[model samples]
Target: MTDRRGVVAKRAEDLVSGVPYVRGWNRARRSAGALADQLVLLGLDSDFPGLLADVNVFGDGLVHLGTIGPEAAELLANLIAAGLEAEQHDTATEASSAMRREAPAA
Candidate 1:
């Protein structure tokens, strides 16, 4: 399909709908603000971040995903959405936790 958003959303649906372990995909969420912040941290030179900034995910910050191109973007969004759908990740929380855990205590 030529519609980028549709393709992306569909891929995400596929992930959340596949595999026995994916039952957790039903409870994902992401705040548009947190998404924007992550996009900056990721440093990807794509419009995906801007697109995410406009998304209204109600501040959950992981329920949605995006990227620079149609094909690749769809793939990434799905991977993330999959983890989200499966309740295997809270990207922002996970990232921060990992950083904290890995950081050396001064």
Candidate 2:
């Protein structure tokens, strides 16, 4: 299997480059919001002030993740992983719903 961190890093890179102009900015904002929510949920908001600041400043636009320090980049990678896992879980749940069966004779 592929390394999860590498996968998340690749995903982040794709999110940063997959689109252009307004659409890309919007996509970055949505991802930033999800990451920020995850940070707060994990109570790590204070641990990565720089990341939070960058998120707040560039959330409505695009962010240059390539220039962030190593610590911030690591935190971002973790957040991206969590987000991806959650998305997968949600997708699985939705797909599983189609396979649900009703109670038999009761």
Q: Candidate 2: misplaced stretches above 4 Å?
A: 1-62, 101-106
**How many clashes (backbone N, Cα, C below 3 Å) per candidate?**
11, 0
Query: Would you give me the overall lDDT of model 2?
Result: 0.54
Q: Candidate 1 deviates by what RMSD?
A: 13.8
Top TM-score prediction, candidate number: 2
Candidate 1's TM-score reads 0.28
The reply for model 1, stretches above 4 Å from the true place, is 1-30, 49-68, 85-106
1-106: candidate 1 lDDT, tens digit per residue: 3243332223332232223323323323235555556656766435464443221112111244443678657656876898787665566678889999999999
Give the TM-score of each candidate: 0.28, 0.39
